[model samples]
Target: MTNNTQNGFFKLTKFEFTAIAIIMISPLLFSWSMYFQGLLIIVMLWIILGLSWNLMAGYTGQVSFGHAAFFGIGAYAAALPYFHWRISPWWGLITGPIVAVAFGYFLGKLVFKLKGPYFALGTLASGEILRIIFGEEELITNGHNGIFYMTTWTSKLPYFYIAAALAIFSILIIRKIIQSKLGFYFLSIREDQDAAEALGIDTVKYKNLSLAISAAMAGVAGAFYMIYMGFIDPEVVFALHNISIITILVGIIGGVGTIWGPAVGAIVMIFIQELFRSSLFGLGPEWLSRLHSLVFGALVVLIILYMAGGIVGDWPIIANKIKSWKNKTEGQS
Candidate 1:
């Protein structure tokens, strides 16, 4: 994940740098289908969400079931300006994260007092409360009517590059954080909060910090979603299963604590999701599309049971198995 350096700060390894370079130039290197390009944007969006959830739950041990609240706030941050004042929604990119972070700070103050499932339920309720409040406030939010606008670009290329940049920025920021003293504090809190407190760490402050960062990342993704999709409703942005649950799955499937885990997870998740939704690119039976939810649920169960640490987390085990298979084939020959 990191290259050892004398100053105790980590740098990107050569392989990591090469992989990033390839990603940056991939669009230019090949003629990709428009569908593939759009899928790339979705993958980046999930990457941001995966990183967001991983920061709070994986690093800090504060599992949240309400990230949809922050995502909705971010989308509305952009949408409301356009809806109410005819202002450009682009401004929401700056304001969205700020608003989400403020909300996170307040929420953390209330929920951090509770621990374990109590905390999870508290956070979960926050998203549901927001959904109801937004849905009822037709005067301000237009209720279930939602907001709609035209996207700025006709081509997907611009959006693809923007999403890719955001994904890269998120990866670098997370990498830096995890390599710093702040990351150590987060790990300590996760391992044992009481012990961290006894060691003079400000557990509350660090936890809040983690939540704020997580919220900001999720908010940015929401802002981008609104800008790209050019439409939003309380249901679409705040859906517990779609936005919040998918974000959690992205993190858990990618390898919760590793740096590149979410990146890989996002890629796998988006492809599987799109493949199923498209019903094998329209070649499969219509029933396949309807079975996406069932298929995804089964996949998640299998991953959890067989690869508890996730793909990246359990890579060594996987590698050994592959090697064993190769050796057995050689012996048979």
Candidate 2:
């Protein structure tokens, strides 16, 4: 866990380098099983979303409840190109972020005027509005029937590698940004906007900047989703409960304000989701499949009650508690 910063923004750490290596080569051990590969790709997608959301909400303190706006826009940006006339969906990796940032800037102009929970609610409303609009725009979006792509590959291996690359790239970029001076400005604004303003930090400008960057990465994830999954509907991409709220929970459960928190959170959330969805590999009852959402709610409640700062944030407390219990048992023995 050693880090060396070169000129503030170009530093590398052993942990980061090791993580990349493990992610790149670990699938070989499983012999690239299609199921595991597909599952890993989904995990990478969520990692991207979690990391993107963490940038603004976790680091910059502008929590958004409507990130689905960017994700759905990205998906459509990639899909529409192919669906309308005849263009490669690959181009979406470029246009998706652009459109998302455009809308994100527009939304930022309005919502950044509000603060705290008001800002969160404003984002929630904005996401819902976009979801409705996309759902109704049959001519342009193909409505509830959704958009589908032929897909670039039959096997999940290629998609898994691509997703892993994306996840790595995004993590590096965000890490650089957070370690730079801009990262400090974001923190100052988050800690106290009025104080940051008093210090001449231009909190409004920085908040918008954070939003734009966050939106871009999220849009990229959305576009990636469209490509990987091959089909998407308004409900699937822009759903409040699934996309938006899950992102917030990822940050919260992972450990807000920490660079690695959302990553951990995304992994845990997705694993738990798959656990319930698969019904413990057919050992559990089929009815349990329907209880994933309920399990998520329960997990969140438990985390908040006992680990207010999330697993990573509260790791010391948890470790100490475990140690104390172990010592007591040893003494009794």
Candidate 3:
């Protein structure tokens, strides 16, 4: 994620340099269909969400089940201004996360009191609570009817670059944090909170800090969603299974602790979903799109059974198996 930093210069390994170059040149590399480009844009958003979740769950060990709370809040933060006050949603880029962080701080104060699965349950409740509130608050939030705005651009090109830049920014910021002393503190808490506390690590403060940072980044993604999609609803933005669970899947599928794992996972998951939606590129029956959810469920079961640590987390085992297969073939010859 981050290489060694020189005097105010961000250094990169060869791989890092190559990855960035590829991302930068993607538009030029292919004349992609807008549908394909949109899918890629979705991948970028998921990467941002996945990385944010990883910071809390993978790194801080405070697994959250309610990140949708922040995402919805951020979207609404932008939507409300445009709906009622007539301010530009672009300002939500700044104000949205600010609002989400405030709510995150509030949520942290309540949830940080618990640990392990209880912490996750607290977050789940938080997401539900927010969903209900947003659904019922018709006067302010437009309730379940949702809010709409015209997107800033009709083409996906501008949106892709903006999302790519934000995704990179999120990754680099997290990389910087992960490389710092705060990263060590987060690791300690993930490993053992009591031991961290015994070492005077102030587990509560750092956990809250992690939640704040994580929630804020998610908020940024949500704000972008409102601007890009131009629509928001409690069911869409604050859905527990869709937003919260999918974000977790992205992290786990990609490799929870690795820097680029989510990016890889996002690409893999979306491609699979899109493939199913397109019914195996129109070879399968037309009902295939309706079965994407079932496919996702099956994928989770299969991945967990075969690779508990996830694809990136268990890459060594996979590589060894492939190597052994190649060796066996050579021996037979």
Model 2 ranges with Cα > 4 A deviation: 1-11
> Order of candidates by TM-score, top first?
3, 1, 2
lDDT at 189, model 3: 95
lDDT tens string, model 2, 118-155? 99999999999999999998999999999988898997
Could you tell me how far off, in angstroms, the CA of residue 68 lies in candidate 2 after the best superposition?
Answer: 0.3
Better of 1 and 3 by lDDT: 3
Model 2, residue 113: C-alpha shift (Å):
0.7
After superposition, the stretches of candidate 1 with alpha carbons farther than 4 Å from their true spots are 2-11, 28-32
Per-residue lDDT over 1-333 for candidate 3, one digit per residue giving the tens place of the 0 to 100 score = 234543122566777779878877776555558887788788889999999999999999999999999998888888999999889998988988999999999999899999888999999999999999999989989998999999888998899899999998888888788878898999999999899999999999999999999999999999999999999999999999999999999888888877788888898899889889999989999999888778877887788888887787888898999999999999999
Top candidate (lDDT): 3
Cα TM-score of candidate 3: 0.95
How much is 17 displaced in model 1, in angstroms? 1.9
* Candidate 1 residue lDDT tens string, 23-70: 777666534577677777788888988998889998899999999999
Winner by TM-score between candidate 3 and candidate 2: 3
